[model samples]
Each structure stands twice: as structure tokens, then as C-alpha cells.
Target: MARPRKPLLSRERIVDTARALVDAEGLAAVSTRRLAAELGVSGPSLYNHFRTKDQILEAVADSVSAQVDLSMFDAADPRDWRTALHDWAVSYRAALTLHPNIVPVLARGPGRRPAGLRLADAVFGAMVAAGWPPAQATSIGALMRYFIMGSALGSFAGGFVDDETAYDPADYPHLGQAHLLAERQDLIDARAFETGLHALLDGLAAQYEHMAGGEGPGRPAGDASTPAEASPGHP
Candidate 1:
């Protein structure tokens, strides 16, 4: 009999199954035995595709990296890096938001992951082309990753999910206002993300101008704009 057109088991198929498992039941559910069952293959069959669970998890994490848009760095104006970085951040956060289970692996620093390495190379090259020092460019990438992953992993508006009823108004009057935060939680979260994003970019913009001796992307040369006030906490 002729072999099937597509193999029954493949690395891509395994990663897809693992991604689904992670999305639905979290990373803990993606063990070889369980994933094998999901794939309708025996446990040993999985070994043909992946040596260890961590290897599978790494592929799964790269799958998330695949969702990011690196086009901003491709054959485009280098000066637009701030905007590019902003767009990249938006895409990165959106991707990870869907797969919060993969953030831990991703946070380990790209390592040998193909997609992750490509992403790092693009961002670093773009910033370096835009007149940023290698050290600063690396720092910027790390900072964005830290902020975006942290944001994606956390519930920014979780406090506003419901009224703050734990503390009585008598002694903890300040705590009682927590319920008010629940109103317009979406706007609260969006504004907060934008605020943080802008602040990070603004600081970089200032540094970029200082280093490049000219205008940074989307801003006048020597632009050192103040950070945005997204919430009551920021001054």
C-alpha cells in the first residue's frame, strides 16, 4: 500500500495540538501522554516528534512569537522605529494575551527559537539603523518585552471587576472607592496600556534625539515630551 500523502504525526501537528491544549487547559495539560491521546497516537509515537516536554513547550512558545508582526522592521524607514516599536508592542501583547500560558517560556529570553530570534534580530537591527547604540537597542527590546509580557500576563483592570466591598467606609473610606473603578473597565485598561506605552516611547524618543543629534520618528528633533497621565496615580 502507498504511504499517506501527509504523515499521521508531524512536528507542526504536534505543536498545533499542544497549542490548543495550552489554550484550553493551560500548559500543565500538555504532557506527552495527554497530548498523544489528543492526537489519536500512542504515547511513544510522540517521541518521534519531540524528545522532551520542554522542547514541545519551546515550540509552543514560538508559535506565539509567530503571531507578532515584524514587517515594521522590513525595508522601511528606520526613523519610524518608535511607531514600529509601538505597533510591534501592540501585536506582541495581543498575541500573548491569547496564550498567557506561554509567557513563562517566552520570558526565558528567545534562546534558539527561530521565530523569537527573528523577532529580536529585526527589532535590534531597526533600532540600530535608527541611530540607537547596540546596548540601548538591546535594553529597549528587553524593556518592551518585560512591559508587554507583564501587561499580557496580568489583569490591568482586575480591581475594577466589581465593587470594593471588603473594607467598610467607616474606617477605610479610601478602599470603598474601589467599586467605582469597575465602571468603564475597558477604557481604564486601554488608557493605561497606551499611557505606559507612550511613556516608554517618549523616554526612548528623548534618548534617541540625544544620541542621533536629530529628530526621532514622529516627533520634532529635540522632543522631550512629558509622560502621559493615564490614571489618577500618575502626576
Candidate 2:
């Protein structure tokens, strides 16, 4: 009897391999021939799984989205919303940073992949559970995603020089002084990811509070008493 053959590789396997390759060597390193070689299969075999390189890239993007863990925010804990959002942003930025090759691909929508849609749905759901209206939740989630992705791209670009780049003091005195200060105390150690994430969350939280307050106890226009007027004192 002939030896049993190994099971045929699926598209998931192909995309997983592509993701690993991109994470290790970047987007340019992934191609039909290269991935086939790595998988011990012929280029034609890859065609059976993915029609083209773009298809493989889309799969890889979807795979990355599937990897996101949203279970941490499943509970209705409004108190922990900030921390949860921060953690989520950090995880997202780390994933993008690790696989900078997929950044561009993800910058485009990953189409109707279940994983991609679920990721968006999870974000919006979490925001809604955390006191945002449906419309505001969707908007905030989208805004946060855009901001985080942009920040990741900038971070991947290795933002802001320390003291190495040349600077002209006469023409740009403030910038030159700022650069000097940055180098003197190593202020360049400031993390773009953390700073951007917190700032975005803070702004979002403030907006949510404003919206919620607008809907509470002060229904009619101009009938809501100011804080000072509400107090038991002459105004």
C-alpha cells in the first residue's frame, strides 16, 4: 500500500505562513514563489489557495484582526473603561509594530472577513456598553482606530531625532533649544504610543460625559440651572 499522504494545506495555513513571513521579513518578503518555497510546495500549489498576492495579503490582514483579544472588555464595567481602552490600544499598537509589513495592508479595509468585521463590532459594542450612544460609539471607535493606526505608522517611522540631526539655532531658535533640551535629559524616551492613546481616550471620555449630561435632568433649553444657581446661595 502507498504511504498515506499529508492532509492538503488550507487557505488558513497559507495565510498564517504569509503572516509569519511578513512579521519576520516584512511585506516585500512575501510572494507566491517565496511562500511556496518556504512551505515546501510549488508556486502553482499556492495559486490553489490564494488567487494572487493581494488575496494572500488580505488574508493576512484578516488573520491579524482575528488575533485581537476583546474578551477583557466583555463585562459592563464602566469604571474600567479607560484602562481597558488603554490596554486595547497598546495591544493594537504592539501588533502593528511587530508586523509593520501589514500596516499598509490593514490601512485598507480587510473586506468582509468575519474577523475584520467582528473586530469593529467588538470595539463599537464596548464603547456603547461604556455609556456611548450608538452613533457616538461608532464614531469614537472609528476615530480611535484611525488615530491608533496613524500613531503606529509614525512610531514605526522612528519619530523625532535625539541630538544627531543638524539644527540651525539662528533661524529656528525655539526648535534648536527644544532639541537641546530633549537631548540633555533624554526626553526622547517619551513614548508616542502611550501619549497618543491616553490623549485620545481622555478626549473621548470628556465627550461622552458631555453627551450624557446633556441628556440628564436638564431637558428644556435655558431652563437648566447653572451650578452656582443650583447651590443654596444668592446668584
> In candidate 1, what are the lDDT values of residues 37-75, reduced to their tens digit?
899999999889899999999999998898998888887
* TM-scores for all predictions: 0.83, 0.75
TM-score of 2: 0.75
Models, CA RMSD each = 7.7, 9.3
- Candidate topping TM-score: 1
Give the poorly placed runs of model 2, Cα more than 4 Å off.
Answer: 1-3, 76-79, 156-165, 168-190, 215-235
* Candidate 1 backbone clash number: 0
lDDT of each: 0.79, 0.68
| Among all candidates shown, the one with the greatest lDDT | 1
Give the alpha carbon lDDT tens digit for every residue of 1-235 in model 2: 9999975678878988999999889899998999888888888988877789988998898777766666657775443667777777767766776676787878775466677777777677776677765555555666767876776564432333555345666776666544444443323323756667778777866666666677553222454444443211100
- Prediction 2 global C-alpha lDDT: 0.68
Clashes per model (N, Cα, C within 3 A)? 0, 0
